[model samples]
Target: MSSAFEVRGGNRLKGEIIPQGAKNEALQIISAVMLTSEKVTIHNIPDIVDVNLLIELLGDAGVKVNRISRDKCEFQADDIDLAYLQGADFKKKSGRLRGSVMIAGPLLARFGKALIPKPGGDKIGRRRLDTHIIGFEKLGARFNYESDDNYFRLEAPGGLKGTYMLLDEPSVTGTANIVMAAVLAQGTTTIYNAACEPYLQQLCKMLNSMGARISGVGSNLLTIEGVTSLGGCQHTMLPDMIEIGSFIGLAAMTQSELTIKNAGVESLGIIPEKFRSLGIQLEIKGNDIYIPSQETYEIQTFLDGSILTIADHPWPGFTPDLLSIVLVVATQAKGSVMIHQKMFESRLFFVDKLIDMGAQIVLCDPHRAVVIGLGRQHPLRGITMSSPDIRAGVSLLIAALSAEGKSTIQNIDQIDRGYQYIDERLRNLGADIKRV
Candidate 1:
């Protein structure tokens, strides 16, 4: 059964909240556990649906999973059932999860063969698997796609041989997948235009700890010296930067005072500044973010006095995931700003729902929108809406929390896939929200 959130808007939430572990990082790191047969322990795993489902999938594949706690688990893939990969159960479960694609790189590297169903996740835009498939082919893996059942079969009968490759785009998952596959190859592999997100860096660091030689972790160029095998290692995920960004936007939208605890500020790289550009005041004190309540905030124009435009780029640039949050927060600001969602075509479509809630917004195109701050002159009115994706779902929730009267948000499962105990956490911060 699907869930919905009934939100009574116009509540000034105030409290301290800790973000869950990084969701993107957890997916890569958990998948990396399969690269080693020895026991691997992961700490700070998010209790979200997607991560939990990946864990369950691993368990079903003959890996021994011991849950140390709600946020910690140990994985040992010593006796993986390779036959399960071709079974209906694996196809059905993996098809529902996009993260399941990452498992292919590890499985192919460690076991010489792997199969994956066409993965599924957010419908924000076109997410191509070309980077992954091409990288695997470069590493001596030949793959064939079964169009009938939407499955991919990859094999390296002679073992993988590493080679230099340049990615057309700096895709985070693509980089992680290629890097994981390259780690166990027979020779040196150099990857240019690789994604250098903090999560990716953490994956490299964890791989290094597990006896793999990887360098250029925090940069776009990565060099890996392939090892014959990898061992187990413990890794703790960084705090979710997307969630931290969401909290900052949430505090500003509801005119609430909120303190986000242990936000991993250094890894946030440019996220805090991006929120500040919208005139949201935030203080970074000892890795925590403090957002003060304000009756109104103004948007900052460019130095040349042009309308400020926020566009998504690869890491070190603003993340694409938080663009929805930024767009929603701008609805009540004091000036105009253009949100250029350059990465995904459909991300800006959610602005229509914001417009329905009395937000002053103009959908310029599929990839862009201009938001004219309401200046608090006219408060947004609550309305019923369906969440389009994970990021947009949270964006709508933020809008509903700041609007007048009550709002019903359907498809909250999308929200739960990314956020952990969101409604319960919001309740702790005095938000008048409940799950139905």
Candidate 2:
């Protein structure tokens, strides 16, 4: 995929969108199934490039990857041909996806120890893995970091033993690591202040299906009783809430009515409330969400009926990943709203693209931005734009497509990393998007 492009905006989207499975959750869940040498069958795995790439990487090192159905997969790591994970491309690709860190725990559990190269994903800011390291260390894993060598090696020479550990932050990846490692440990392991996001919860459920003992399904605390081995289990992936949120923003911005079937309403907990603040209506009927075409959604007023603020926090709070979509939607909203991206400092940098398209916004700092919506006041003329990160880039593409003309967004590779066949998927619902 080329890294650049031009966009002619101004198109209203109209259609029905069935959300895909969550990529983040699928990645971690697949890795977690490696606890035992047994066969694991998974369903609803998105047929995207990254998933294929991960499968290829695993296959080369000798893990059986098979297709049982369109969205189903059967995998077994009984024959791990390569004991040492040494390859530039593998390391680089592993670093690309958010779930790459998850394989660390599974690898250790299978091989007793493993070498991890520095991970790569969104360059929002310094995404720390200290919590993951500390949690593993508490389970009797020792680490050796080699800066010049670009290798981070760790080992559980005496095997991992269950221990109580607290996460410094509600990191999804860190929590996943601990969960994976503890499943095969010697005793009971407790994780406090852990990330209980839908993805994390999905991982736990998948692990349990594979015979791992876990308590506290959807809370900040987790209890895992180590098991000697695990066997294959059939599991389905959850709907992508982030993608659903993106579609809601797209529908609102383009005045396009859309039906998101089986939207995983249960996982959308406080997300709807956050989007509602921007006047985006997500009407639920059974498992579907109805986002009607509206010229401009109204932003909520404050307690004094002035103005309300929309900010991102940890899980159970508004997801920082969806804030980019919110910003794009706010441009067409009736009133002004503040967007606080407290998690990553560089996340707000992409606002410059929206600003260039004539959206009124002020970048307060690295982590804050105040958007004064145009309220259908001025039509946004499409212009050339490039995607910076996965979420922001796709949000920009949505904005560009929802604007006034034919828009071509570049750096689509980043967008493809998360959204599977986004152009085709959106086009099925009447969105005019094509990759050049």
Candidate 3:
């Protein structure tokens, strides 16, 4: 049954949830192995099913990976068994993972070429690789369709070179491809208007530490100077910002106070202010944030004092992935907030489940929803529903906890992809939930 999570709902959760390494960052960082043959040590790595699958994928392809500790690992790609990457079993397992697509550029970098099948992830919307493909093409790579096998063969004819490339959109995978390609190119490469999310920045940092010359670390304009080789470097992954954000929403929804440690507040620029518009109180303590239990909160309206709207953008703005969680948190606040998800057409469809639970939300369109914070409107009672994606599953979980009755969340595998043992972690904070 695709692995479901049955969450018994209607519990006030109060506890400390330690953040794990960022999944998005980990995927990219691990893929960087193709740039060198050194033994790379990554600390603060998240132990999740997806990352495990990625490691298995790496090991299956002949990379030596070892678990040095709970949050640390060692990777050496000197002996990748490229020939073994074929076959149905490999394709099937890789198809189950979204990050598998990320390996193309690295594999090409490591072995002059890559044969990759179509990758998979949450059924969010159309995720095209035109940007990624074009980036590779600009660097001397030629692509051909392997129609019978449902795969793409990208081969660098005379090796990669530095070039000026513009992405159609600030695609994260595209940026990663360019970053990996640039690491081994013969000259300098300039990427304009790239996706500069904190996770992406972390990847750049790790790559730079490994001897790749990359400038403009936290900006849209990235300048990478291709080096002949990169040595192994030790890097500690940052705490999961999404997890911190989730906790912020959780604390506000159930009127529970929480002090989140090592939230990397600098990396969360504008996020706090963004949450404040929804009346979420946050007290910053160096790198930590203290969320006080509140009895009443309201979403701020327009500057002229009209109903306000919160929307998603590429980066340095609201992440589209978090829009679902924002929708649920808005339901507990005491005002109205419009959620405009510009990227994905069907992301707002999940709100129908919220509505079924008596939430005061109006699905304005396929991409927009108006959430009227019910305060205590119909208090979500226990219900059973299937998780749709990674973020959606966790948002549903937070909503279920705020509801007054018992609820069971099916399809928990989605939640496991991003968050680590969410039920067990929340239970430590006083939540009433049992996964059966």
Candidate 4:
């Protein structure tokens, strides 16, 4: 049987934990390693299943992968086996991860041909690839989809040329793909309404270090001047903002005085403010967030005295990934809040598990839920439940830690894909949780 977390609830956790490296950022950076043939030493990589799987995929494609430490790895893509990318085994491996779609851009830019199987990931909603495909096509690439095989073939035989494109949405992965491809195209490429998240900025900076011309970073508009080739450069990942937010929610829900160290506060756009609206008080000291034990937190209403509505948006807004944590924290606040998960339809479905655990929540629809805080007036009863996805898994873990009696969380692999040694970390903070 797969591993499960056996959690004994009602413990006030203390001590400090550092946020791990960004999982989403690591995926993009690792894929960009294929853009250069030189040795790329990346530091602060997260130790997680999803990232480890991507490293394995790269090795299968003949990229030299060396693990120097638990959090550092070097990759050299000098001898990429293009034949392996079209094989059945490669298709099977790539299909298991959504991040695999990103490989198409680097491969196409370097070799002018790339194949991708239908990618798989968290079934949050309809995560379309049209943005990535459209961006590639705008750069003068011809794309063909083999419906029967459920795979994609992208080619730029004459070589890609830079052009202008305004993405329909600011998709993070889409932006990374187009940027990587544009870095080697024949001319200057302009991208409007681009994703300017810190991750994208870091990736852009890293590429520029390897001789790519990119301007207007940290904004919606980006300009990339193509280079004939790219060289290897060392890159470090930022702290995972989603993980920091999750820890904040966990500390508040369990009434624990916990401190999260090296949280990279500057990159955390609007996340702390969003948590503050939920009545969760966090003291930011330098790069650390301190959450003191509180008897109760009262949710704040809008300036118009209307009920607070916490929703997700693109970067510079509350991230959809952390909405699950927001909703879980609202269940213990002194007032009610409506959580509107704008990006993913099925993400709010995890409220059912919290509702079963004595949380007063009304699932208005697939994307919205109203949580009425019980204010620690009532203790939640523990129950066995399976994890649904990465974010929801951590949210459920937080709920379990605050509930009464013992709780068992199965399918912990879902959590393992995003969080690194979460059970052991929680245990370090005085949580009565054990991996069974």
Best by lDDT: 1
RMSD per candidate (Å) reads 0.7, 1.7, 1.4, 0.9
Q: What is the Cα-based TM-score of model 3?
A: 0.97
Quote the lDDT for 104 in model 4: 90
Predict model 3's lDDT versus the native: 0.83
lDDT of 1 by residue, 172-235 (tens): 9999999999999999999999999999999999999999999999999999999999999989
Task: Write candidate 2's Cα lDDT for 174-233 as tens digits.
Answer: 889888999999999999999989999888888898889999989999999999888888
Name model 1 segments beyond 4 Å from true.
none
lDDT of 3 by residue, 1-436 (tens): 5655555554555555668888888888888876778899989889888888888899888889888886899999888777777567777788788888788888777677876667577878877778888899998899997777667788986889889988889988789878888888889899998999988898899889888899998899999998888899888888888888888888888888888888888887667887788898989998889888888688988989878988888889888877888899999788898899999887777787788788988888889999989876557766788887889888998888888777778888888989888878888888887777
TM-score per model over all chains: 0.99, 0.96, 0.97, 0.99
Judged by whole-model lDDT over C-alpha atoms, candidate 4 comes out at 0.93
Off by over 4 Å in 3: 2-10, 86-88
Worst 10 residues of 1 by lDDT: 110-119
Ten contiguous residues with the weakest lDDT in model 2: 3-12
The better-scoring model by lDDT among 1 and 4 is 1
lDDT of candidates 1 onward, in order: 0.94, 0.82, 0.83, 0.93
Alpha-carbon deviation at 422 in model 2, angstroms: 0.7
Clashes of each: 0, 12, 9, 0
The TM-score of predicted model 4 comes to 0.99
By TM-score, the candidates rank as 1, 4, 3, 2
